[model samples]
Target chain A: MDYQRKYEKSENKNIKKISIIKYIICVIIIPTVIFIGTKLFDGKKYAFLTAVVVLLSCVPFIISFEKGKNSTEKMVILAVMIALSVFGRYCFSMIPHFKPITAITVITGIYMGGEMGFLCGALAAVLSNFIFGQGPWTPFQMLAWGMTGLIAGLLSRYLKKYMVALAAYGAVSGIIYSMIMDIWSAMWQDGVFNIKRYVACIISGIPTTATYIVSNIIFLLILARPVGRKLERVKLKADIIEKD
Target chain B: MNDKMKIFNTYHPLGLFIYFASAIVITMFMINPVMLTIAIISGIAFVLTLTDIRTFLKNLAYEIPFFILIALTNPLFSHNGVTPLFFLNGNAVTLEAVLYGLDMGIMILGVIYWCKCYSIIVDSEKFIYLFGKAIPKLSLVLSMALKFVPVFKRQYRKISDAQKCFGYYATDSYFDKIRNALRVFSCLITWSLESSIDTSVAMKAKGYGLKGRTHFHNFRFHIRDLFLIAVTLFMDIVVFTGIGTDIIDFRFYPKITQINLNAESIAVYGAFIILMFMPAFLEIKEKIKWKYYVERI
Candidate 1:
């Protein structure tokens, strides 16, 4: 048992080192490359920007999965949650622009950890688009949802305890999703950043944005406690990570 | 195995992916009226050839109004052109803006159609096959997520049916319905989460995530795939050059530019048309060949 404890301690140390390296890569190296590439490659900046965003988005999952003690179990849980989120979107297809995907993603993050949340959010976007149809807007959707999950996971301690905070986060996520998408629209419209056009795009998207916010609030308020409780239970049962 | 040899299905997944990606990138970037028209027509033809008549017509019915909405909305926001068609809220609805809006609408529809075709062609299997080697864990998670969608849906249906049998109908009061729905959802969460433990255990037992693991792959890069890739690359290069050199450029803002129908522009248009219509043309050729051979037999 003492030897087992020593082995586990070494494994934890390794995970910590790997995570630190991943953070540096995700936060520093990727953005620097994108900035430099944009400056250096005048003709292909858009492609370069997209490639960077896509690559950065995967870092969380890669780091988290590698760091976790029971990586397979953690992956399975994340995969299941993402599937649930995607299915939730389909379930709400009768209502226009009303989906529980964001809420589920946030909940996944709050319970599973931020990295898992991001994975759930990003994968949910890509997978749901398989049904809804893919477009230039897909990457934006992925970013928006992935960030939502990541933030929720980061703030899970405060959020898991307070229903109001969870609801607020959901509303904010909805706005973020709409705003980012509007940026995409404006860019697509003019092929350059025009402030007037972007503002117009934002103004035009208000109604849908409002719906998204309300639906997010409703879904989060409804799903957070029950879902969070169940997920926590699963994490414990599966021994996904060592106890703090 | 015999199904793999069909023209539309024959190319290596990577080859097909490159073709679709290049096509989409070109279609989205180049907003030339001629190019947009070719894209829309070819997109429609491809959709029709690939899907049944009923599905094709259904898609068109959905697409046409969406097209109109996008085209009509653009003129409202953008008042760039010189020729004023009408005044809306004291803003001049310029002819250029309307025409540009129409072009944008067509481009949007064309991209959507192409994306639909892409989804049909690149099933989850193909997607996993392409990305699995580089990111095995991610591909595994993605495949599991996809598989879980239907599984969870089925479980939800079963749970709801069971609840209904116990007189928990959603037709009750709004609050009651919401509560009951939440109850059903929570139950699904518990059930699925519990089952995933079993799944992970089974996977671990099967030696998943271990070193020296080998996987079965059905995809093979044939000579035809190489030819397809070469042709697609050639077309993309020609189109990109034309765009880069401003030979096939069109401007809508400030004023609409006159389209040059010169030899270079025509070549650009021809290359785009060929690229866009390649799938539809191949599918038709295969259909004709099958018909002729059957008649001879």
Candidate 2:
């Protein structure tokens, strides 16, 4: 058991080291690729290339799951979380622009760690779109939701402790989602990015954004305690802990 | 399944995936109005061949309003172009902007139709097959999630029904209804969490993620799949090189350029149309052959 603990400690250190590289790729490499690719390639090639890059960025998170103990259990928990999030979206389908996907994603991050949260969030977007119909916006949706989960997971320490902070994070996530999607809309509108058009897109999307914010806050307030507690119990039962 | 063998249906999953991926990428990148028109028409034809007239019309019905909204909104926000059509709030609405917007709208509509067609062709099994080799863990989780969605939905309904029998959800007020829904959702989370523990234990008992774990594959790449792949790659090369070399140049902003019609450009267009409607053409050919065979009999 002592040797097992020492091995896990080393693995945690290695993960920490590798995660910095992942951050650099996600933050620096991806944008640079997009910027350079757009400048060099035509709209079609650029769009395809960007989608591939975004999908590739998810590899680190997927790989990170293997470094932990009880990988199968972690995977099962993630699948269940993704399924529940998708089901949450369906439950609120009657309400226009109101969804619990973001709130659920944020809570998942807060409990299961960020990498699992990111996976769940990203999977929910694609899986839900299987029923909602997919388009060019699918990649953008994945990135947005994935980032939401990542951010929530990164801030899980604080978010788990405070109810108010979690709700605030939920509202911010809604805005971020709208903003990312608006960028896609603007890019789709004109082959090039036009500021005036992007601004107009945001303005037109204000109502939907408002609904997102409201639904996120409402859902987070309602779900964080119950769902978060249940997730905590699962984590305890599985004996999975976030390796420092 | 063996009763009617169409080319697309007979091809390897990889070949089918390549066709749709290349088609969608090329369609989205194309800015030339002429190319877009060809794509839209082929998209419609593909939809018709794949499904039925009802589904084709339904897709178009869903797309038209979105098309109009995008086209109309472009003229409102984008005031770029040479030919001014009118002035709204001191902004010049140009014919070019409207036309540009119309092109974008058509592109989006075409892409959406193509994606819908793609979904019909590529089921979750095919998707898992394509990615499963590279990311075994992720694929397993994805397939599991796919399985769980229907299960969760049924569970939700059952739980809701059980609750309703106990008068737990009998509230008439909107707020009360929302509260009751939240209660049902909370219950679901608890149930799923408990159930997941059982699933994980079962999976572990099966020695999942063990070393040298072998996966079962039903798909095999035959000689015909090779031919299909070669043909698609050739078409993709032709189209991409044509676009790369400016042989199929098109600009939508400032002013719409007249499409240059030459042998190479026409060839590119033909290649694109064929590639875009490859599956549809195969299905049509099969239908014709079946009719002829029936008549001879």
Candidate 3:
């Protein structure tokens, strides 16, 4: 039993080491792409650059999913989280910018870990776009929300410990989502990332940003505890089923 | 609704994928006025052949506004180039900006139309086949998620009804309504996660995601499909070469660049025209052949 425990600890450490390597590689790729993107690309190219960015950002999560020992239950849970988020988007489609998508995505990340969270966020963006008429903004939407989930999952422990942290994270997530989306607006307008154009886009979309912040906070605060409890039960339930 | 009515259905999924991918990528890369215009016109013209007039017109109704919105929005934010056309909020809404906006709109519209054609032709089943081998897990997830959306939508209705029965939701007070809605959402989340356990068990029992899995695809790459693919490849190469050599280059910044109508430009344009309008031509040919056979019979 002692031997088994020691072996497991070593295995866990190895896994952690591998994940760090994975992240470092993924991190290196993104800034390189961005650096090249800024240097080489101009108007019309930014749209494709954003698309390339989406692909590069998503590949790591997908690679992790492929490599990891993700059970069927976890996959289902991720799908369910995405479905719930998409449903949330559908429910409040009549109300502009008022969506539980960010809250749900954040909660998903917190429960499912960073990789699943990223997939959840990105897939939700893709699925919602499918439902809501895909446009030029779809890739950016995926990038923003996918990163939101990724960061939330990575910082899940701290957020879980403190209510204020969770709320603050939720607000920050909204800002991040808004800022990333406005990148598209800036790029689409002038074919490059001009600060003047970007700020103008942001200023114009202030109402949207406010709505995102409000909805994210409201939904996160209301749904976090319950969703966390449910996800815990779900984890337990999966374990029980797996034993059978 | 008839598959015979459209030529898009006849090609193999690989052929279809290559065509659409090349078309969209080519259209996206170029900011040339003439090139973008060709793309938009071809997309519209090709899509018209595939879909019915009424539905196309209905889609067009919103699409026109979308195009206009993108076009106008471009000028609003962008203050690039010489030749100021007008002043909007202490910014020069220059001619370059205006023209650029129009080009972006055209490019966006072209992509949308081609994608619409793609979606209409390549159903989820075909998509699964196309991407299944390359990204098996992602494809599985996509198929599973697509399946689950409707399943969960039904579940949502069931949960909402039960919640309403318990006086949980379906109230008038705004804050209360929002609270009640969240409760229903919470309830659904629990049910969904609970059900996911059962789904995973069921999927495992059925031996999903097992190694040595064989996927059944009825997509036989016939000679005609190969022919279509070859032509698409040839045209794509020609067009890409045009872009690479700056033969098809037209700019709309500072001042709109004059369109070159030389041999290289014409070759580039010809390749693009053939590629984009291939489906329409094929559909017309098919219709004529079908009519001739019917008349003979």
- Leading candidate by TM-score: 2
Q: Which 10 successive residues of model 3 chain B have the least lDDT summed?
A: B1-10
> For each model, chain A TM-score?
0.83, 0.83, 0.82
What is chain B's TM-score across the candidates, in the order shown?
Answer: 0.91, 0.90, 0.83
Q: Give the TM-score of candidate 1.
A: 0.88
Stretches off by above 4 angstroms in model 1 are: A1-70, A242-244, B1-6, B85-90, B170-179
Q: In candidate 2, how many Å is residue B155 off? A: 1.6
Off by over 4 Å in 3: A1-44, A240-244, B1-6, B50-61, B69-93, B166-180, B283-297
Which clashing pairs does model 2 show?
Answer: A44-B29
Of the true interface contacts, each candidate retains a share of 0.70, 0.73, 0.49
In the range B196-251, model 1's lDDT, one tens digit per residue, is 99999999999997779898878898898998999999999999999888999888
lDDT of each: 0.82, 0.82, 0.79
TM-score of 3: 0.86
Residue-wise lDDT of candidate 1 within A56-77, one digit each (tens)?
7666566656555656788898
Candidate that would win on DockQ: 2
Give the Å error, residue B186, model 2.
Answer: 1.5
lDDT of 2 by residue, B58-118 (tens): 7668778989999998888778789998899999999998998899899888888889877
Candidate with better TM-score, 2 vs 3:
2
